[model samples]
Target: MKLLRRRGAVSLDDRLAALEEAADLADGRLEAAAVAGARAVVSRAGARRSLSVDHTVAALAGATGSGKSSLFNLLSGTALATVGVTRPTTSTAQAALWEGAGSGPLLDWLEIPNRHEVDGTAGGGPEGAEGMAGLVLLDLPDHDSIELAHRLEVDRLARLVDLLVWVLDPQKYADAAVHDRYLAPLARHRDVTVVVLNQIDRLSPEAAERCLADLRRLLDADGLTGVPVLGVSARTGAGVAELRALLESRVADRRSWADRLAADAGAAADLLARASAGAGAGDSGDRAGAPRAAEPVKAPETSADALAGPLTSALSQAAGVPLVVAAVAKAHRHRSVAATGWPVTRWIRRFRPDPLRRLRLGAASAPEGDAVGRTSIPAATTVQRSQTDTAVRDAAAAASAGLPEPWAAAVRHAARSRADELEDGLDRAVATTSLGASRRPVWWRVAGAAQWLVLAATAAGALWLLGLFAMDYLRLPEPPVPTAGEAPWPTVLLLGGVLTGIVLALLSRAVAWLGGRRRARKAARALRASVEQVARALVLEPVTEELSRHRRFTEAVSEARDEVRPGRG
Candidate 1:
């Protein structure tokens, strides 16, 4: 009998734990109303516990002419509640207290100003039924009452009551106002809810059975699949014992309040789960061997690998890396030509500005400020800027695609959060990267020494030729000039020096061309590497962080929905 009569299968501790878990699940995903409602459930549960677990508050509620007050009186075995055919007879809530057991604070919170005491020993309710001594049965005003205050009173008591006995008549059993507005909202409370077909005496047994079956169908459609429904006549006492026994069972159990609260939490949690189910849909696959819900939600998956390449390319272009590379090659060629070319023509190379120095870039002896300073690199053209914008948004979109609402937006924001910093970051990267153009190569110095030696030889040879001409003009004796092959000594010296200097200059120019190209390629690679780093730090980091946050939110909501296993609790 004890097992059969227990109102809830779960202990109070278990139910409370489930409620807390559900509240945790609803932290960020649910609507404001749902979060507030869950908090209210927890708050009310705590308040109810602090007041009295010994007292069970049950309310009998119905339409204006449903005989709910009469049923309440019958259950209490006293005419504690007003009963009449007048519309909205009970404007305020009335309570029938039993066994002189006090529930003052609980009733006050319930706002039941009218109270009546019942003789616990009268009517021989049942032997060994002393456990129901703390029952407070309330007869509430009609939910469909003409008076707005009466309906408001019903709403208030219905939310607070530990148990609810909904009284209905054959005539109004299918009332849309009652079913839609009242019963449907309490679908979560089916375990603590009872549906009574009152005024059964007015119908034949077959008609009453048919009405009860129809009500059961309606309850099922309302998500109250397992709720109990009974047919009773308050005047004939038919099925009244069953209703009273059901109430007594609930009132006897101290866990009924916890069960009611659990139902409320579960309902709130379920609604929140539905709200967020579509969120993070394309996130990632399930965690590696991690336990999940029986039917787990699909998580969102995003990869920054694909985004990295395009992002780096865009940044490289925007930072003028190509122009820098070209400058590096040209600078190398300019310096080489100045060092190894024929000394006389080398001055011509000097007049051409060093390409790197012109751009304020890669000068070995430049000031510290020059190395860290912004370059004369041209601003990115409109096409380049558009490409960069498209790259950033595309990366964000790809990573956030199919993610649930809010989290998807969050990821996108994280990706673009640092967009304003991109141009400056890329510029800084370009400025700081070592483009290898600053260092003068050892070969350039050796070649410069060779060029000076050749120029000196050419100078001495020209002087000898001029001295030969001057001696012939003045009829002076000429110094001995050694002849080679068919050419005169002075003429050979003059022509050979000129031809050798010109040949060395042409060879140096050819070497500079090859070395310049190689230098350009090396510098471009180094600069682009720097650009990639900036992209990762400025763009990828934020998006990854947002995705990580989305993952945590998903786990929290999943745990809240599936962790406790409400049925076990």
Candidate 2:
């Protein structure tokens, strides 16, 4: 029968365990000031290990002139808390400990210096007090006291008590200070809270009912919909039994502390959950309604995969991959033209520098040590540097778009974690990439040999013609010069060799231009791949790890938040 009634209610142990988990999740995500109340709940719950579970600590709290002390005395059946007609009574919190329970450590933790034992026959009828053996009733200073210290004492004890019985007078039942400062904030804590219209004897039955109705409306507006409200007169003892019965029921349960702490954890978790929802919706200032589902799940809007393209592109540009590939293509054409051009002008072309060697980078320039070495390439221009920085920041923002502030900050940190090493790392990556332009093409060697043969033929023909002219000039007998139909053989050989070499050089230049473009494209692809690898190692990996941490934290906090159902057990 008990299980059926408490089917959906979480056990005390489960609630405490969940509270512990939630507290850990809130450490950095929520501000320490914002989460202080929840941390106090966890700390008090742990402190309860040394306290007795059988004891129920209840406090009577009210604004000035509310008869809170009279109610406290009536409940304890003793004059422990002083009563006065003066505006403020009970400057410090006073506890009435029933004799059967040991509350030494509990009172010490409560920090109440004034305590009275109310279990003996001297105070009143022992039978009534005997039934409330494990109860510890406290009379707290007026919440609206003129003395700041008295109000501070009330505020302090208000948080430590297991159950709060707010005592209000008929006239001041709708006071803004009480409802705004206390009741509204404790809306989620209604399960462990009660409101009593004290000194109800001042009003007739109809007037009492009307005041109660007005108070109920205020409570509902304050977000305390189902909290129990009663009417009682401490002076005439009318309706005092009902208030005592309520306290007795709380004491009998022996789970008031657990329920209070559980509700506290729930309220704190709900605040965080709503804030996160508002952030995910892109309106961080909005106050989201209470979570409707049992489990609160956060599906991050931006994933690591979505960050790859922008990050890689930025790193590629930062690494000077485009400039390096352009140099490779130019160098390939320069070397090819020099090797396969006509021999007459090839030596002059050699005076110009190889574009790749000018940069001191290529497959040949990789550093020998594990430390990344800088390339001798020229520094990026101011515009290029600015663009790189902008790209990195944009990628970080894109990767953190829908995440909570903490997670977004984490992603930004991860993206820039190795920023100082990026210039050198990217330079090293470019230096190590294979340009494929290093190996000379076989056709260049063959074409060079052909050019040399043409040069030799041209030289031989010219020498034969010079010998014939010198013999004629000396008036000596000359050998017969060969003839090719209408033209002299020496002149035809000389012209054909020079013209053929020029034509071959022109053809090779055209082929080199086309092949150089293809080589440039290949080099670009290879460099981009290397740049992508560098991005993954330095930037994407850390962002991915942060995302994983965020997912785990969300799940843990969600589990804790889901465990504390406000109206449920």
List TM-scores for all candidates, in order.
0.75, 0.77
Alpha-carbon lDDT of model 2: 0.75
Model 2 per-residue lDDT tens digits across residues 83-142: 887877778888888763578888888897788888567333676666677888888888
Task: Score candidate 1 by TM-score against the native.
Answer: 0.75
Error of 2 at 16 (Å): 6.9
Q: What is the C-alpha RMSD of each candidate to the true structure, in Å?
A: 7.2, 5.8
Q: Give the backbone clash total of model 1.
A: 9
Model 1 Cα shift for residue 381 (angstroms): 3.2
Best model per lDDT:
2
Which residue pairs clash in candidate 2?
Answer: 9-569
lDDT of 1 by residue, 309-386 (tens): 898999899999999999999999998888888888888987789898888888443455664667789999999999
lDDT of 1: 0.75
